[model samples]
Target: MRRTVGAEEGDKEEEEAEAQYHSKDFEWEELRAEVENDPSFCQHLLPFQPTSTSSSSSPQAQSDSDAWKRFHIRHSAGKFFKERRYLLKEFPELASCNENSKVLEVGCGNGSTVLPLLRGNENIIVYACDCSTETVERVKEIIDASNIISIKQRFHPFYCDLSINRFPTWLACNQCRDIYLQSQHKSISDVTMNNIMDSNNLYLLRESGCCNGGVDFITLIFTLSAIPLQTMPVSIKECFSVLKPGGLLLFRDYGLYDMTMLRFELEKRVGFREYMRSDGTRSYFFCLDTVRDLFVGAGFTELELEYCCIKSVNRRNGKSMRRVWVHGKFQKPL
Candidate 1:
């Protein structure tokens, strides 16, 4: 079978359908009550305090990136690549945005998120990054194998360990990031500042200066959960700096009390709401409050935030599974 770009299919996991996109299959509070009341789920509720950052059980920020690098290498066969068709429904702005809208997909694993963004809007340009060199190269191969229009020009992939390092200056110049990071009391008016960060002016800056102004959208789908919990705030701030004024950040990640989170053994607990897999990659399940404080603290205005609760059936085991995901939209102040 030939691989094609943006072909929607019902994969066992993440089968993005309309009902799955909009409908609340179950109430999050109800699920929380059920999980909290059950003894089997009690361990996940236990509060955890890190004994030490250097503890063997606690995932180190340095090795965490290495673990992901190894993970992509092992699963680089494209098994994990699944198109998120319902993404356009969840965040329609990606499909409806103006021509040549720039999108930065943080931790662009297997190019799953990038493909739909490309298919939704022909004119959208996506710049994706992953820590794993294997993933970076693998996703490039997957997109190259596909038949998307202007694939070369529209899709750009690079390797960046975002948790530990700042984004390349080309994504946002010193001036653009300074506007968001520094004191607002500048010589110029806020209106004039925004106008300068506009897309047309941004490209012009790319020609003259060392960087483009900023991105229109940043997709944080399931990416933030994998970073070391300690580094999450800095990671989010990094994303905030790279977004254009008023640009939206689309986020979806594992949520608290999800079936997956509940399944982790007691030994897997590294920190509060954090767990590590055998292969070394970490997962952090999010609650609305935790999600809000992180982004809002980083200077984004919360536009939409909620728990996406759904019940899915395990095809092989023939058992019902309760799934929870945090969905959110945040925008930088204009």
Candidate 2:
């Protein structure tokens, strides 16, 4: 039921506790100093060299989405989804934004980010997408099961691989109402979600064909790193294309010298600052410079970028673990 992706149960709980207090408990420079000064962690800092099994044409690279699909299926049961209540604190605009302001959540896993946004802002409309259809449906199920008001109308889940494909035109179609989202009810017997991601299908009912619009905000909460580094440029460009002028893009992901990065074995290294887990899913750790380049290079104006370093103690072993995460906010030029 409860699967701790990278950290153990104690560390995850500690993180949740730490979030309630501060975004930065210690300086990232301090952690970097401690890590770099130590010789044992040298392998993670060395330049990465690709191996045959880890090549771009390898199965791991080709099936990254498939790997995530299997990940969702593996943890499908018993309800371990943690609602990210802290997101509202980090991005208060979502809680106090204009009514009916549309937001697109890329790689919304298990509704951790969705539930809070839905609960915090009843008037906001969230259109969530993931590479896995199974993950998409599961998010709908998780959020629908919550006791929020009119969520059936505000929460829209669709299947699309944003890494390889662009968002559906209907998402940018100003005159359309996703009947599939608006018409959802207690029983979804009549509605078929098979074509939810296609603008040419019956799933979308439009008033006009104008596709010159974009969402007010896009939340990339730990979403970008799942993708292969090579495809990140196009993926970010796709995100930039779908955001309205002056729209904000919220970002968060693993930071360069985090404890997890140090824990990875040298053999797990697939690319510079990148590693693959036993489950076949890969994680890319970002430094501030890399984060800035990715967003700015995609034509976004960087507003805020920094490292969040938090130290949490593992209750089981009384061991201390320092976690590092990148936090950022970028806006499309008005």
Who wins the TM-score comparison?
1
TM-score of each: 0.88, 0.83
TM-score of 1: 0.88
Cα lDDT over the full model 2: 0.76
Q: What value of lDDT does candidate 1 attain over all alpha carbons? A: 0.80
What is the C-alpha local distance difference test score of each model?
0.80, 0.76
Spell out the clash pairs found in candidate 1: none
Runs with alpha carbons beyond 4 Å of true place in candidate 2: 1-19, 56-61, 78-81, 173-212
| Cα lDDT tens digits for candidate 1, 1-334 | 1111121222224343222323376899998898899998777888886665534444477788899888888887966757776788778899999998999999998988998888778999999999888999999999888889998999999989988889998788786677555533334666575655544554565678757677999999888998987789999999998987779999988889887788888888888888888787888999999999999988899999987776665545667767778889999876
RMSD after Cα superposition, model 2: 10.2
